[model samples]
Target: MDFSDTIGVSAAGMNAQSTRLRIAAENLANKDTTATTHGGDPYRRKTVTFKEELNRQTGVSSVKVKEIGQDQTPFEQRYDPAHPAADAKGYVKMPNVNSMVEIMDTHEAQHSYEANLNTMQITRSMLTRTINLMK
Candidate 1:
């Protein structure tokens, strides 16, 4: 494939991974957040979905962030009577965010972004060398 195609594909990958990282970060940041008002639900974990697309101009395959959605799992209940968001039964709703899972997802997104960056860099170098050779 040509350098332009490499750049286009890598750019798409980077964009998708960047969105993944953002969602993961949001989940991590709100892990401890409980319901603000009485008898309300706590923060739910957010998820990112990706899709593939064809770059018509470059004729390269690329990825895109398809959607951001909430986790369907039920909120965890903690027996904390004194909490502000506690229900009548003295139970508080806890955020569904899992720290370990979020951390792992963050790492994966970062690595994918890095890989795309590396590909773009390598393609740039190769293209530069080809141009120099032809001069």
Candidate 2:
């Protein structure tokens, strides 16, 4: 196996984690949003799905985002008679995003991204040392 393949694989992982982080941020931002119209659907939580693909050039498996889909979980109902989005029963539908869950996801993505970055840095160092020794 080529040593440079490690950097390529790690870069793919970092990209995937970045996408995940973005999705998590979007979900957190919309967590408090409600539908503007009565009895309308509120902003649903978003989720990212990852897939692995083989790099034809290096034969290494790399990570990629398969899809960014909405969470299927039901929305939460809050009683607020004064809310413009309230239904006939004085209930407003809230986004399904859970702040705690989104926070955890964001943390995970950050850790993964950092790990990939470290791997890439180490690979670069190894390559640099090899080139120096050849001189």
TM-scores of all predicted structures: 0.95, 0.96
Model 1 bad stretches (over 4 Å): none
lDDT of 2 by residue, 53-120 (tens): 99887778989999999899999999998998998899999999999999999999999999999999
Candidate 1 lDDT, 101-132, residue by residue in tens: 99999999999999999999999999999999
Please give the RMSD to the true structure for each candidate, in Å: 1.1, 0.9
Candidate topping lDDT: 2
Question: Residue 20's C-alpha lDDT in candidate 1?
Answer: 94
Best model per TM-score: 2
The regions of model 2 sitting more than 4 angstroms off are none
Taking the candidates one at a time, how many backbone clashes does each contain? 0, 0
Q: What is the lDDT of residue 127 in candidate 2?
A: 92
